[model samples]
Target: MARRPRLEPRETRAEATQAFLGRAADLAAEFAAGTPPRRIRSFSEAAPDDLRPALAILSEIPDLGLVVHGPRGCGVRAPGPAPLAVTDLDQRDTVLGSGEVLAETLRALDAACPVAAIAVLGSPVVAINSDDIRATVAALGPELGKPVVWVRTEGVRSAVPATGGDAAAEALLQLVETQNGPREPGLLNLLTSTRSPELAALAGQIEGLGWRVNILPAGARVAEIALAGRAEASLVLAPDLLGLFAEGLETRFGVTRLDVALPLGAQATVAVLRRVAALGRATGGGGPPAPPRPLSEPLAGRRLALALPTAWGLAAAELIGDLGGTVAVLSVPHLDRSHAAALGSLAERWPDLQIHVGEGQGFELAGLLRRTAPDLLLGAGDAVVVALRQGLPAAVLDPARLIGAAAPEVLTEAVDIALARWALVRGAVQNARPGYTPGWLKRSPDWHIKQEVR
Candidate 1:
């Protein structure tokens, strides 16, 4: 990232599928060799596509008018701090084309609010109905005197939810299309969606180095987004929103993209800041780092299993090791080239770390949990439910908590709280309804992660 070279040009952000099953070491090796076993689950359950997250991400941008062209239940009544409208397409409208309805929604939303820019998020319903979303946006944008973009997010484009983030970033870039321009020295773009005290502090730390920091997209004005190309470098805090967005900025606007791991703990934060200083060529030294908050590693002398998203899971495992814990199994929704760097680093430290790949395939997770039987299970969303059904003590891995200065202490306290409830959970589920096949739990976790024979 410190190197001053233009990014390699890549055209499309399209993806077929993510990497298949293997050990962390093996996956890393194959990835490095450009032969990672990319496959599909033949008997996989129906999973969600990019629409949910894509709409969610776009809706986070403050004052950005958003219209999802589908039924009222398309993206649902997502409660957020952004203005969102829906086309409310009915059966007749779907058959007759909702171009008029879409234009009306856009014009109404544009007229009502002082949105910096407007985006039309296409859903599966509209894609199947073949609505002309782009033409509608193009016709209305000039009349309204504002940028209107169409973010394609059919529920079948990609299994990886982060692809939604890619679509969101592309829309953000398109909304703020700028001409080629010179960059400012020590100007860094800290890309994040949520605002937290920890991240605010981290940004302060960077600013202490006498450099300019521009927080973009989320909670940012259109002017800040326009200055994205002028930043000397870009650093993404949200892992899912990383690769495609940063790469696009570099490719289009000559910004440097720092490919660093998420700063989960104090050590990681320091390492990232140091990289930033070196890259940004800081003249005003920020001096040595301050001591982190005093707290013991709650998972010390304990072993645990991790079921999380790829980037966060891998980084959390490394941090867990630093805190004196062992990660026996690392289960993630999907793995791809974006994870190659973290995967390579993790494989070296935890060479024996068992890598479980599947997106919401709970049977495989149940089997792996039973096989390894770690003292605890750290997971997120539905994966945590799968663990608890087996009466295993588990804690939800909140991405927000696993970042910044408070992460170490926050995560430790969460583990302690979950650990205290172990006996209660174990006893309560003894008479619960059965959710898994006992025989399946005895089989290999990857039994269902079959090779793509086609």
Candidate 2:
């Protein structure tokens, strides 16, 4: 037999991501076979001491059971009082085969609790034969009549706590769909993992449209999610997590799927809303149109800069142009080629705009602002620093604030609200007299106010 191909070294997170994606592709090919593909639990070499972050994320889903497989006295904490069941894979099991241990664990779980899914947390020893452990679970799942979700975190070393969170989202999407009954006209379900402050607000906005927004594993339980199968359509906001699920929902539930661009600014937002409106009309869920509003207030006279992820920056710039804003600069690290090309096209379309690309360095924004003197900054985290230094009002629009299997419409609405708030704040700041106290400062009663008597 020919020698197996040698694997290349991984030196960066991007490289690791590519490797992971490759593995996912291979798994997808395997899944195409009649048998179910093995589940992935975590991406770490050794299970971390605290699984709270992961467990807390999983707890959002009702009737979800976590099965922790480790040697006795392994010191893995059980998830807080939520129907969680744990099984110890002892030393003897590791030396021999994991088949018996896993079988016993499954039997115990089947008798004691309701098991919807099973995730494996790799210890140093367990990581050795993760494939065998996975196989053991798969063999037992059919016997127990439950789906097995395995996360293979064999050789990873990153400290990113959300790896398990992503795995959980993936598992849920695999199970939930929109096909329990006949489709409801004008109703849409927002597929998301968890609710952030921004996402919560977006859900409210969609609800205002008389659309029943179903947030998966966040505001709604598993039963409610099953009921969401009847929604007229589904919107996928977090592409990475919701993409696979959206495809499944369309196939199983007969729900129309809209894979619109994520809304980050005025133009993308309007486009998304229009698409949603069209979907509603098609589904006989049409309602009276809200009064037409200007795409954006006059932005042409003002200078603005954006610091965000690639797609978000592009969308923001497009919307800023719609509002007549002169985009002085835009920046984001890890700028993919497509985003770069899009930015180049936008620059060619609007020659007056200036754009910069860089990672979030302390001096980067200050230096750019000194040269460009932008009137406003739209960013997630680092832009706040620019705003403080330059006395320019800034908006926070972090994508992390929109976690989980978010519906596209809900994502669009969240961005719309954030942009609106940012624009209003910037406008108020621009209209204020120089040295006028900021509203945020006034709102803080604990702050010392020095009064000058005339």
User: TM-score for every candidate vs. truth?
Assistant: 0.87, 0.53
Q: Which stretches of candidate 1 lie over 4 Å from their true place?
A: 1-22, 178-186, 279-298, 437-445
Worst 10 residues of 2 by lDDT: 13-22
lDDT of 1: 0.74
- Model 1, residue 426: distance off in Å is 4.0
| Candidate 1, 1-454: lDDT as tens digits | 1332321211123222443555778878877886454466656654656677676667667788889898888857335556888999999887777899999999899888889788888887875678877788789988998788878775366656667777787777775464335777778898886667777788888887767888866678766777888888898887665466787888988888887768888777877787777764555646656656544666788888887767788888887877788888888867766677888898998887888876767887787777778877887867778888877888787765677756777667767867888777777667777677777667766655655554
Off by over 4 Å in 2: 1-59, 67-127, 139-147, 151-170, 177-187, 194-211, 227-230, 251-253, 263-270, 295-310, 320-396, 399-454
Inter-residue clash pairs, candidate 1: none
Model 2 residue 327 CA deviation (Å) reads 5.7
Q: Every model's Cα RMSD, please?
A: 4.8, 14.0
